[model samples]
Target: MIVPVILSGGSGSRLWPVSREHYPKQFLNLHKDDASLLQEAARRLDSLDNVAAPTVVCNETHRFMVAEQLHQVGVEHARIILEPCGRNTAPALALAALAACQASASARLLVMPADHVIKDEAAFARAVMQGQALVERGRLVTFGITPYTAHTGYGYIKRGEALGEDGFNVDAFVEKPDAERARAYLENGDYLWNSGIFLLDAKGYLEALAEYAPDILEACDSAYKAREEDADFVRVDDERFARCRSESIDYAVMEHTRSAAVVPVDPGWSDIGAWDALYELKAADDTTSGNALHGDVMLHATRNSLIHSESRLVAAVGVEDLVIVETDDAVLVADRRCAQGTKHIVNELKASGRRECQSHQQVYRPWGHYRTMVLTDSFQVKEIVVKPGAQLSLQMHHHRAEHWVVVEGTAEVTQGEGHGNTGDMKSFLLSEDQSTYIPLGTVHRLKNPGVIPLRLIEVQTGTYLGEDDIVRYSDDYGRG
Candidate 1:
């Protein structure tokens, strides 16, 4: 059986504003109307035969998002492994291989990054079939995209010798080349863009890692051995895994392995590395003016540009070759030619300690989500939504007092003084237009007891209204 291992650890800084550190591009519905990029990755495997439910490797902060998205896409029995920190592709693959090998040592892994776009599912499945044959022969297999352009943004792989009708032994892995060299590579007809997709034997990968990157293999092994299952997630030991050095599979194993092999295929693939790449993917569907407009956007004399508006109308006049992205809290305007420089702006925002670089106004949680509507020195207001049967933690805030006004559905509220006893605790129902107040240091909990989502407005009066002010007694989501 083939175990699909989906790696989703990218921050997607280049797709900033819409794709923040907390909610990255993989979780956004960039291409498909119904599925996000990660969902597309999971669903694409449905075309293949004998593939198991995917083992998703993601950051600890994105565990809930990963699980929820996969569930929405009807992918059941998936193993969602949470990495305490980012250790790049090598360690991520190690964790996946270790977990997969638990069930069968000879399991073949179809490694795919969660954030990629592959438009041709038939071609992808065919390539995987070819890769499966090569992998079964104890060869480490990586897919190489048939280069259509002299694009310097991606690494290149030179084919050494033909292994079979559809495979080649990798001669060398070339770094991103300069313009002149990239043009030469496009003309050479023997190079392929390194696609970062791979098919590998689980035991064979572990053996290769042990030979070339024993430190990484050992660290991942220790962490996997000490892993604990929390709900639908596998939590590896943070300290042990953090000690694993950051490296890509190319550098740590495939670069040095004698069994390295490459399968050349074209599946209309793109990493969506920057806005210009997104424009390129979307440009064909637009008018002859080469404008890709999304949401409420109007353009006059705008040529070869991509404009996206999330909350309000965005209008552009006489602009050419530009990218304009408008979110609730931020807007990014850049020349299309310099779109890759967007990451530098994210870095500057991080260096300046800006929260805009981290999340949007609406933040997601396992229960539901909340959006800050208003804020001031002494007071703040938020719109909170709770999913049916979902509840928040039984907690209290030392620095804030809250008032909740129900807007829709029904709420089962538990509020009291001290530690919520039968006498002190009051269990009550709050319907539409109903309100309640929880004084400072009052341990309280809110739940959606109805069949529909519960929506409410929360008013906070406090000296400090940060999220870290809460002291939780218990949480259903296993959050501390």
Candidate 2:
């Protein structure tokens, strides 16, 4: 059976405001009404024959999001490998290949990125089937998108000799070119956009990696062997994986392997690398010529623009080729032509030590999520939701006191002295409209033992209200 390996380890900076370092594009339902790119990626191969559950490789920080999105797609029996740090694609693929081989000796890995969109699902499946045929003959197959435009955003693949009905031996791999060179590539029909999608025999890939990129393969092997299975993630040894060299498969294996092959496909695929890409995607489906609007947005005399509003009404007037994205804490307005360069904004934000670059006003935890509603010098207000049967850690703060108002469902409250020297340990249930207080230095835990999500308003008064103030005595999600 073919095992799908989805790589979801990118800090999508170019699509910022909507895509942050902590919550990137892969997990977002960007079009608003559809499944996220990750969910769609997880379900893309459901129509294929002999397909097993997928294995996802993502950053440790994104484990919960990956699991939650997969669960939303009904992919219950899948592996989620957490990389301690970003080690790039080659190491990620190596770890995935090792895991696949362990599960089934003869497993074939159909590898792809989680943040890609393939509009033509049937066509993509057909390409996968074609790739499987090529892999059967000892070839490492990569998908080369048939280029219709002079797009400098993607690398180019040159097709050489034909191997099968639809597959070809890879002649050369070219980096992203200048506009003139891209136009030349488009005019000449021999080049294709490298899609970074691949199909290879798991054992064969390991052997090739051993031959070509020994350091990466060896490091990944050690890390995989030392891996411990956590509650919902495969935890690798941080130090071991950190020693692995960061490289892409194109550089580490496929580009150097003699058995490299390409299957040309045109399935309306996009990496969604920028806001303009999203604009174009929505524009294709929109009957209007000038605007691609999302959320509660109104556009007037807007020509070739994208306006996205998340929380409030956004009005755009007399704009042309502009991109306006509004979030709770930040707003980005950039020229559509320069949307791809928006990564510079993220770079600047990072240089300035801005929190908006890393996360949104809302933060997600294993239990559920919380949004910062208001903040002052000595107090803050938050809206929190805990999933059914989920609970917070038995924790305490030295500088903060909390007031919680139960808004929905029931909250199971545990308050007491901390660190097992039990004193004033009490437990109670609070339904809607009920309230409670947690004094400073008081050990406490909030749980949702009910069937529905527990929503509450948390108002805090403290000299310091940072998240790092927590001293966790016991945590269900294994955080230290």
How many steric clashes does model 1 contain?
A: 0
In order, how many clashes per candidate? 0, 0
Please give, for residues 74-163, the per-residue lDDT of candidate 1 as tens digits.
999999999999999999999999999999978999999999999999999999999988987889999999999999889999999998
lDDT digits (tens) for residues 170-260 of candidate 2 = 9999999999999999999989999999999999999999999999999999999999998658999999999999999999998899999
Off by over 4 Å in 2: 418-424
Q: Which pairs clash (backbone N, Cα, C closer than 3 Å) in model 1?
A: none
What stretches of model 1 exceed 4 Å from their correct place?
418-423
Q: Relative to the true structure, how large is the alpha-carbon lDDT of every model?
A: 0.94, 0.91
Clashing pairs in 2: none
- Candidate 2 local distance difference test against the native: 0.91
> Lowest-lDDT window of 10 residues in candidate 2?
416-425
Candidate of highest TM-score: 1
